[model samples]
Target: MQPQSLQLSGIRKGFGADDVLKEIDLSVRPGEFLSLVGMSGCGKSTLLRIMAGLETPDSGTVSIGSRDVTNVDPSDRDLAMVFQSYALYPHMSVRQNIATPLRMRNLSLGARLPLIGRMTAKASVLSKIDAAVNEAADVLQIGHLLDRKPAQLSGGQRQRVALARALVRSPAAFLMDEPLSNLDAKLRAHMREELSGLHRRLGATFIYVTHDQIEAMTMSDRIALMSSGRIEQLGTPDELYQQPATVTVARFIGTPSINLLPVEIDASGRVMALGRPLGVSVPARYAGPAMLGIRAEDLRPAAGGFAVKVLRSETYGADRYVTGHLADDQAVCIVMRQAAGDPIAVNGEGLSHLVFPEQRAHLFGADGNRIETTVPARIAI
Candidate 1:
C-alpha cells in the first residue's frame, strides 16, 4: 500500500475536571517519522490514542490521507498500531499470530470456523495469506521463529513479531506507542537503529510516541514536544534544541538538561548574569527580568569569564563534566570533550573561569517566551 500522511486538527481531550489534551494541531508528511514526546502526564499517549481511533476527541478531526477518519472505527481507519506490550497470544504460534489480521479481513464467518473453515476456506486466499506472512517475516528476519509461541521468544524477537504483524497489513500508517520500552537498555538501543532502518526500507509514515528524549532525537525526522495538554514546540531536533520557543521547551529537549540562570536587563539594555555583564544586548524597548539558557557544551573555560568554585567533577571516558556554583550561589556546569588526560580537579577552593558565549545563549522573558537578543562585536567579559 502507498504511504499516506496523517493530520490532526484542533484536537482536544479531557477527563473530568482536568484537560489532558488542549487544541492539539499537527500534521505528518508522507513517509515521515514523527515522534510525539513528553513526560508521563503530558498527553502524548492520549493524543496517539486519539489518532488511532481508540479514543474519540471532544473536538477536532483526524484524517488519514484525504479521508477524515474522526468518526470511523479503528478497524476502518486502515492504520496499524503496535502497542507497548507485545500483546501476543501465548497459545498461538508466531505464524498464526501474524496471519490473524489477514484471516479476519479476508475470510467469511463460516470459512473462519476451526476445522470446517480450514476445509471450506478458498485455496487462493490461504495461499495469499501465507505469501504475505512469509514476506513480512522475511522483512523482520523472524522466519525462524514462526513456529514458536510467545513464551519461547525473547523480548526483542517478540517485538519483531509484533512489527511483522503490523507490516503484513500494509496499512496507510503505523502508530507505535513505546514499542521498545519493554526491552533492556542495550536491546532498546539496538531496536532504535533497527526501527529507523525499517522505516527507511519500508518508506512508511510512522507516528511514534515515547517519553524518552534520546529515542525521539535519534530516530524522528521531527519531534512534537508536548506539555500540559498542548504541543509546546514542533520542529526538527536541532531546531527545537538550538532555538527553543520557550524556557519550558529548552529545559526538556536536551540531556543533562539545559542550565537556566536568572538574568536581567540593565538600564542601558545590557544583559547581566551573576552580577557580571553577559555582553549581549536586548532591544532597548525591552527590559526587566529574563532567563539565560546555556547548554552544558556551550559553557567553556575562558581566561576572563566569571569565576566559579568547583563543587564536583565526573569523568565519562574522554569527556569530563565540572559542576560548580558562582559567587552568588548560582549553579553552573561545564562539559569538556576529548579530555582523557586533562581533568578538572574539584576542590572547595578551586575556581574556574567559565564563559557563556553571547551567541550561544538562549534568552527567555519572564512569561517564558523566547526573546531575541544581539551579540555585540566585543564583549565585556
Candidate 2:
C-alpha cells in the first residue's frame, strides 16, 4: 500500500494558559486534497504549521511517509507551503523565486553562489534544477512570467509564483494556509478552480487550511472541521452538509445556516416543538429537552402548516431567503436566525405557524448524538 502523505497523532498546542489545538489525529492519503477549515483562532493555521514542521506541538507526533518528523526542521520535511501572503521575493524574477527551493535543497554553498556557483556545481545538479524549475513553471502556467519580478506581477501572477516555488520541490505533500485569502472574491473563486485542476494533474497530496466552508466544500476530497482547537467533524462536503454530527458543524457550514428550534420529547419518544408534534421516533428513555434542525430549503410556503411570520427577506439572484418568526413561542428559536423585527405572514395569506415536515426533522439527544429512531417511523423528528 502507498504510504500516507502526512499524519498527525494526538496533536495539541497551547499558548501559555490558552490551548490552541486539542488532540488532532488525522491522515492525508498520498495524492488526495484535504482541507482544514475552522473559525479564527481555532488552530487551523497552527495545525498546518505543525504539519509543515514550522511549529512544534506541545504534544503529539507528525510523520511523512514512514519517518517520524516530530522534531524535524522546516527545511528537512520534504514539504512545500504556500503562504496566504504569497511570500515572494520582491527583487527576484519569477524563475529565480521558483528555483529557490530547488537550489536550497540540492545545491551546496559554493554551487548556489550566482555565476560562480553555476559554473562550479556538478553538471548533473544544474540540469536537475533547470528541469525541475521549468517543469514547475509549465505546470503552474507561469512559464510566461519567468522573467517578471514580484513587483511587476499581479496578485494572481504572484500567487502562481509562490505555488511554483512550492511545486518545484516535488515535495511529498503540499500545505497551503489560506493561499487565496489575498485575492479578490472573483479571483479567489477562479483560483480555486485552477488549483483543484492543478492538484488533479500532479496527483500530489494537498493539505489546505481555510475558514471558508465554500472553499472547503468545493475543493476538498474530505474536510476536517475545527472549532475551538478541536475537530468538530471530519467528512466529505455532502456528508457534513446532510449528516453533521453536531449543531455547531451544521451552523458553521451553510451560508444561510440551518435553523434550529428548541423542542421537547415526551416520555413515549414523541417530540414536540412550540406545542406541535415533530413526529420523531426516539427511544423511550431519551426524551425531554431537544433541538430540531432543518435547512431553509427544507421549508416550503404551503398550506396546513405552522405560520412563519416573514420578518425579512433577502434576494440572491437565483433564490430568496425569507426570514420570519414562528409566532410568539420563544422555545421555537432559530439557532442561526437572520430574521429581524416583526413577523410577516407574507404570501401565507392567514397562516400563523411554520409547519415543519415531520419526515425531515433531525433530533439531537441531550448528549448531542442524533437519535437513531423516534416514536414515529414515518417522521425523523
Best lDDT among the predictions, by candidate number: 1
Candidate 1 Cα misplacement greater than 4 A, ranges: 330-338, 342-348, 378-381
Candidate 1, residue 301: lDDT? 70
lDDT of 1: 0.88
TM-score of 2: 0.91
**TM-score per candidate, in order?**
0.94, 0.91
Candidate 2 structure quality by residue, lDDT tens digits, 277-343? 6655677787789777788766765456765555557766656677666665543433222233434
Tens-digit per-residue lDDT, 237-336, candidate 1: 9999999999988999887688787888877888888787877888856588988888887777777776777766777887767777765565544443
Query: Which 10 consecutive residues of model 2 have the lowest summed lDDT?
Result: 333-342
Please give the lDDT score at residue 31 for candidate 1: 95
